[model samples]
Target: MSITSFSFPTSIRFGAGARKQVAAHLLEQGLKRPLIVTDRALGALPVLAEFRSHLGGLDVAVFAGVFGNPTCSQVMDGAAAYKAHGADCIIGFGGGAALDVAKVVGVAATHEGDILEYVWDHPQVRAISNPLPYFVALPTTSGTGSEVGRSSVVSENDTHLKRVVFSPKILARMVFADPELTLGLPPAVTAATGMDALTHNVESYLSPAYHPLCDGIALEGTRIAAAALHTAVTEPGNLQARSDMMMASMMGAIAFQKDLGAVHSAAHALGAVCDLHHGLTNALMIDTVMAWNYEAVPAKFDELAHVCKVAGGGAAFVPWLKTLKASVGITGTLASHGVKPEHIPRMVEIAVKDICHQTNPRPCTAADFERLFQAAM
Candidate 1:
């Protein structure tokens, strides 16, 4: 495949008190009524109520029905909410799922068919011709980096598989990287999400695609995650650690514009087949996947080792990752997370079709995916 142009378009406001800037930014854009798309749990939080107080003058409607993995129906519902409130803009106010729903809702509200019809590589999917509403993302967690991403992963209702919708039109116009908002996350969430960010950086760096910009960004992002993830998880109130993790997450997303690798493919399958959290699945499977992929790019693994401050290179990197996962309180194999022997065949099938693995340094076949699943198990 021929390499092409690249773009980093999101305007970022990175610091404490950045969430407080949302109202002024919206006003500057002439956006009056904004629909807040977030998960049910976050919507019920007192923090959400408090955040709404910042947009007192603007008419804002909250659609908190989005849950675990965003489904096609939820995206449609979010579109309905956007229409019902006459929203002029969208504010993605929580984690990856909420942000993904918000992005797709913008398209679904103005488009003519089911949201699934726009999925990347779908048989009946259509081009995204309609312009999405103005969008702003405020991620409450330091993972997924969906805040700056141009693609949204939505789970298909029929297949229970995750499908990506990639469109430049859905990219957030503004991103508020406020560490204060992530302070309330528990240790488990912090660990899982941090691992997700790290996986993005690692997998992208190992991908064979030729994008120097992504390569550099992935290296730095990995370094930042290595240094900050443990602290962020253990001491959630540490703003500096939180800030570093958030930066790593955003940088990971930016780097992954080139594409991801087998880790993401396996993780996507896990999310689809077992209904697992996207980040958690990635966290659990990355080391196993890397072990299988190490020989394909031993030099890259050495570089990764040096960047992450691990003592050894290549195969030793896997143990370092395991140590990091344990230190951050993320434990459990795929089987422990609900993957069964019966699920392996279907998981491999889904993984073999995942687009992320196309860029993997090593070619991954269905048999390789089966072995990876078994290793994780």
Candidate 2:
């Protein structure tokens, strides 16, 4: 149930006009027809219009039926369109939802049966056709680096639960992380999504893995998020800050391959039940989870404290986090997101099932999830 090998995508282009070169990249991948998967907002925007214009007379199909947190049904629908239209590739052109949907569609279009059947430790089905068409990830808001990463988190509405489909090959044949396109993200979304990136780095850094490379990547990613997240929130037009945040977001995904801890375990569960913003949910429980882990990994926190100028121990970390949270305007409790205490039991059960819990520094049982949920409350 564990992997000792690591592999990443070979094609990723990052810069100012990376997305604008989609046509060229698509051609390079030998994609005759591409399904551009995006959300309603981006699908309706002038950016999409520009893509259409650029792809004039080309065999291009657009499927924008994406929910905030992607569901298996959504991916199924998208897969149908992809099959019907003979899409030779998938262009994930929005935030995590779009990217996640595109990843699932690519898998479902070729694989048989329900998506959840592919969960790790018990992959009901396995193997994908070599050169399984093309998947080009063009991240706009840059929270969940579904671009270069190898897993997709899709919500199963029947259970109000999130499931992970893991594989490095899920990464796009190419990735486009352009900051210019993200200049339009609202301040609130900027704050929430940026915090999501911070959570990824923190969780990955704390994961009890032997990968020094991931550890280094996670720490640097945290530093980048800490330094740039607030500025990106307050000033959307700050290209420099936006660019840094975007890179930080990508770094979070890259690092987390080593491991993730309780924050992710909690947030993944909370996200399904409350349907809260993933990043914001993580932010709500981050400090709390860190405090819980203080005893298990004090040296890790101490290192993070020094990296983030947190100073001292548990006492210093909380206040420093509060200051940063306020700076990004992310200071809200779970109740603010309409969570009810009565729902804690079921929530804990789902959180315990998430694969992210497996890599957590400390084992989190159902009781642990309930306790963490209570703390976030």
Candidate 3:
């Protein structure tokens, strides 16, 4: 198999068996005792067991308490595990939630006070001044791209509201992207996560940020997702489609360094108030949010239409999104996914306060978010 090594935002080793390089990579970084962070479900899978077997003679431990929509407590627990095991580095070995927790744990392990004290935007929180243990990310899914991101989204244990821990120091030292790891994902998960990747690309491109480099990357990422998401969902064993989607997902994360828009703002709110999967929330709300947003940036949608190969430019893009969502078996309204009318007020409150809304092509208000939530329902 051909392997490619490159760095856009982080060092990446991309190929079919890139995960097999994890041991050597860790050794190169002088990590002898590494703590593997992953979700409980994935930790139980044979794939992980098989992976562990490959690390002959190295000290390794697993922290598998990470749950969906990871909480700050999980980060603390993982950090405790890191210290107890005398780990020298962190290996994030699953999807976004697991990887995010691992990133936070890496920082929290070395810092003092509660983990929340380091959350972004908290006035009392101290800056993350200390360098963290080395991080090596291995993504088992082709979305979120948290493996390459510098922020980790953790939810408040009491309120379940999403909070971000942002710092350039949190970026991974190395990313081992292996498409073979994603081949076992269920179709629904593949579809939802693929749409999440698409949303990232679309929202980043539509953001009003003045970064031409991110604009070009976001546009190409959109095209790659539009072309490969369906094939990856329908043919789970197709490594080529999986590879393309993985590349698109990484590009989307890199591009979003420019900024994201209302789609993520709304999705983060949903994840907070409704306890929904981040990517699935993005997938379900994308059409309604983009439809309302099209008038604000019609020219961007026109460009998006061309990239997505839809005729009629801006007017056709929403329909194209609907078509794409349906073809990949992603069908639902917000209410169908457990959101309620009474929840709209709080969701709107959280959404407008989200940092993502600041970069929206058109400014959004609480009222606008309420309407979007209503329409989504």
**Each prediction's Cα RMSD?**
4.2, 4.4, 1.0
TM, every model: 0.96, 0.93, 0.98
Write one digit per residue (lDDT tens) for candidate 2, span 1-377: 11111234436677777766778767765667998888878888887786567665458889998967888888889889889898888888889988888887887888787667765545355555445557888888868876778888888768757777888768777777778888889888998889889889988988888999989988998888888888899988998898889889988998888878878878887788888889888888888887777788777887777777666754577678778888888876787778999878878887787778788888888888888889888
Candidate 3, position 70, lDDT:
96
- Candidate closer to the true structure by TM-score (higher is better), 2 or 3: 3
Top-TM-score candidate index: 3
> What is the lDDT for 24 in model 3?
84
| Tens-place lDDT digits, model 3, residues 59-145 | 999999998799999999999999999999999999999999998898889999878889988898788988899998999999998
2 or 3: which has the higher lDDT? Answer: 3
Ranking by lDDT: 3, 1, 2
lDDT of each: 0.90, 0.80, 0.91
Candidate 1 lands at a TM-score of 0.96
Model 3: colliding residue pairs? none
User: Sorted on TM-score, highest at the top, how do the candidates line up?
Assistant: 3, 1, 2
True lDDT of residue 332, candidate 2: 68
